[model samples]
Target: MGVVVSLEDSKNRQASVKPLVDLTKGDMERVNQLILSKAGSDVQMIPEVANHLISSGGKRLRPMLTLASAAMFGYAGDSHIKLATSVEFMHTATLLHDDVVDESDLRRGKSTARTIWGNQASVLVGDFLLGQAFRMMVDVGSLDALDVLSTAASVIAEGEVLQLSVAKNMETTEDDYLQVIRAKTAALFAAAAEVGPIIAGASRAERNALKSYGMNLGLAFQLVDDVLDYGGSAAELGKNVGDDFREGKITLPVILSYRRGTPDERQFWRTAIEGGENGDENLEKALALITRYNGLGDTIARAQHYGTIARDALAPMPASALKSALLEVIDFCIERLN
Candidate 1:
């Protein structure tokens, strides 16, 4: 699906998430069960809407982070499972809400729940999932974990608002873009990773390290996602290739393309993104300008910068199967740009 051969980094032959998946398999099963159990409700429509998204194909990386983080510290209690389930619920809830806010028609190559159930039903179901998530968190009985996760919820909301403010605004800077992703995407990752050690009662330094790793990994992941919107296909991205452009979202590629173009090119961007001329012709033009300005390449470079930091974050930990798997996950995040 990556027709752009130039972007594919086949050199990272070792990049794979299989290790992490294998390492966390047993606990992940328990987490998945808990997720299904918690997502159910007496209200038939609740499960119907919740399962619509929950059953959709996804890597469930955030919940896996929770499991691996705790397991890394030798946490044996079942609380980690509940925490992982809670993390997944939080992530799913966010996706449901995001689809509504973005007015998206597709997710994971399927119609968004919002499209079928309607925005009001989708939103209410999202709130239900969030409520269930907090319920599971409370059951876990870790104040530190709760603190981290609750903070992340608020931060994610703030990020959404910040994104709304910047959408179609061509002046959005790289720093502004970073701030938005750190909140919306990376906050959950940071909290998910941090809670694992918190629940395990690990050293503060260890928790801090995992938190750092998760945040940087998320940043790299999102940067690559922004690149993929222009370079990837629906089969690969699990969504329409030009969804971001059609929505007038000012992602990293668009920001770079607009800021680094000729005056006429900049005007084209303003018309397409800000002035609501987001037709197929405009999307084609936007893609050309993005490729011409090396927007995808430079964004990937930025992703690599964060990937290095994420790798460094794990240096202090002793080598193990899990540690190696975690590193591979980092590589997978950046390599997805291909």
Candidate 2:
């Protein structure tokens, strides 16, 4: 299908189904088993903390991406299961650290690792999980595997640093926002897709294709996440609405609102986010400003644009159910808000 048509299909599918693909049927069970096993036996305290988040039941999108990418390339070995589990371990480690850094109390509607275990314990266990992830990758026995994950780890740290530097700063540009998202989120997704072909010894073209697909999908996923923080129900989104604004983190919708708001709306932001505190009363005004400026529409459009790019990236791959599932995933990314 053409890129535009594929994008439309993704949109349509997203409206009907929350997820573009379901991983439960194939190697997903094996991958999950490996992930639990890799959490390690000794160091009961650390492993317990890691298990807390692991068992909380996230969407497990990263590992699913890894398996899907390998499947797309026609890999049948069990190594993909190990690698996918490793990807999930790395992802979980980051979240543990992220909650500590953000001083967050809630994740997936439960108390976060840091909240339950204290910051020091959460940080230490996060370190432990990161170590386990590398050890697992070493067991996988691919230098290419090391290259993808090590680079992604560095990028994730950079993204965290970038986010820390920009917090509560009104001078952040759209480019700044994109940099943070690429580092914090898109880098891992790209690695998840790229590693499959790297592991399976697929052609360079195929590797690049999967990489682009992953990057675009990651971007779309994050945009929707940011948008949902402003527009979603707390129950539906599994966190407090306006948490981004409350944390003084300006995401795409807020940035768009700041850029396009009327003079009064601009002044409201200057006081609420820049000069004054973001009070509960200001939330209505904030939402109104974004609505008036069409910030939500602009943000959603950007997400859809990335979803289109991701779907188009699948064209070079041979037709398979796995490839089709990946396309559906791109659709799910864009339609998640609805």
Candidate 3:
């Protein structure tokens, strides 16, 4: 496998989403309007909670992917707009539900909806958005799109359950963790990219290519998130650092550190992660150990592995502005470490 290119090796590697953003700007505006329209309701609190996350300055990358994938095929219709909006709603609902599950106090560097409106309100509003997303899918009149999205919803839930099962369990293996992230994170990305070509009536090979690209991109994205949780700041990650450790969630860093540490270091991790000794002091200790083991660096290397696959997934497609933008996005996902 090709290793991640160092920043020094990749000069002029503009690893930002600007090209894709610029290409999909007009469609994304419509998607945003639809998102606001669908998130509205007679119940005031529903919009309040929904809008909290919606307006929280997220990159809106998922919906943009839908738009880009469709436009790449020269799709000139309004259906992509609704589908893109539906994709955004699905993503927003997941965030609301995740905050409640993780008991997260913040999202996108702002207070989470659950913290302000309570977990019940957050979960209910998430459900409301999900219902609206399906309604939009139904409006599209494409059973294929519906099947892809609905199956993704089910798989995401299963991923969450699997993660919960492994929480605080030091025995979690690398393959086990990969399975959790694949379902929880990658499934939506795969669906979002696939449905675009599905609605555009693209060939099966074209659709499968985008799906594979999205799945590996999602894996790399989540692995970078794992690295950032320990090494990044609240502004960078949009959440408190060490939050995962406090929650006893066994991420890649913890798994690596635990597996490679001496017995005494392993015992310390057990005390910190399992025995609920995850205070600020322990968080400091955990950081030291993670650095000592180069866990953060190695996790980035793993993300690079998936990123390479994502790039290769695009190889069969003809080179174009859209293809170039999509390929650069893979670099952006991993090179965030730089």
Candidate 4:
């Protein structure tokens, strides 16, 4: 393990965004087109829901990672695009289902599928997308690809279940939180990055390096996201600032702040975490306590620690523009806050 770096250690810069942009040139347009084209059906309802969500516009970070990983290994084939599209479909399906499960009102600054199409339609369509993604994998014709993606899908479901199980449980430890994140957030990222090497026929060591890079990067990304839920404005994050607390979802910073709170402060957390009375009031108190205890700073340090690990994973690969872009991706994970 390395000493974690604080947010105050460096100012945010544009250099961090360079790598992701470089590796994912034209990916947004291509990904959306692929998603819409593949979601084709005679039934208008499936296409309508699929097109709505697919075109809603996310950062396309998952597919970018797949392409970036392949580029890093000097892979020149077009097959990475198919694989990347498959990964994006899987990720989108998860989000659609997640909003339904979480009863969320907003996602990516717009109405969620569940909100528009109803939970039944959203859930079934999500399942359809999952099967569509697998159909893509079959087209790619690689058992290695299938193995990594299939395992990742299983882990993602498990992670969702783990988080649901721990909800409203104030006794949840940091280790338990990390486990959920590894499964829910990082699993898809790791699979997306690793699929490149499998498709490119890279050696095991190279494959592992890409996997590590994605895992660490994904962890850093999600840790920052959790922090932003409390620290960022709704406009900046494009979602409710206190939505996590309101939903009784205990994240790392809130859990850490609670652990370090006085008896009275702990009582406040117990109410908030357990969905007791004065929910909004308790959210305010919890936010204030987190700030008082430097929970935000601690959270940033943890994200930076994983960002460093993501960078380390790139060391064994041959130097290229893709390599530089990979480093930038780690920095982007940290810099996005600013």
Off by over 4 Å in 3: 1-9
Give the alpha-carbon lDDT of every model: 0.89, 0.80, 0.88, 0.83
Worst 10 residues of 2 by lDDT: 1-10
lDDT by residue for model 1 (142-188), tens: 89999999999999999999999999999999999999999999999
**In model 4, what is the error at residue 172, expressed in angstroms?**
0.3
TM-score of each: 0.97, 0.92, 0.96, 0.94
1 or 4, which is superior by TM-score? 1
Overall local distance difference test of candidate 3: 0.88
Compose the digit string of candidate 2's lDDT tens values, residues 1-338.
00011123422234422232454346888877777787867878877898899999687888888888887777877778877787888899899988988888788778898877899999888888888888878888999878988999999999999999988676688999999999999999999888888888899898899999988889999998877777776764667777777777778988888887667777778788776577777877888777777777788889989989998898877877677777777766766643
Which of the two, 1 or 2, has more TM-score? 1
* Candidate 4 lDDT, 44-136, residue by residue in tens: 788888777887766788898888777666778777878888999899899989998899988878888788889998888889889999998
What is the C-alpha local distance difference test score of candidate 1?
0.89
Clashes of 4: 1
Clashing residue pairs, backbone N/CA/C < 3 A, model 4? 19-325
lDDT of candidate 3 over 1-338, digit per residue (tens): 01122322355655888899999999898888888899899999998998889999988888888999998887888999988888888899899999999988978889999889899999999999999999999999999999999999999999999999998888898999999999999999999888989999999999999999999999999998998888876667788888999989999988998999999999999998889999998999998888889888888889889999989988998889999999988888776643
Candidates in order: C-alpha RMSD to true structure? 1.4, 4.4, 3.1, 3.6
Better of 2 and 4 by TM-score: 4
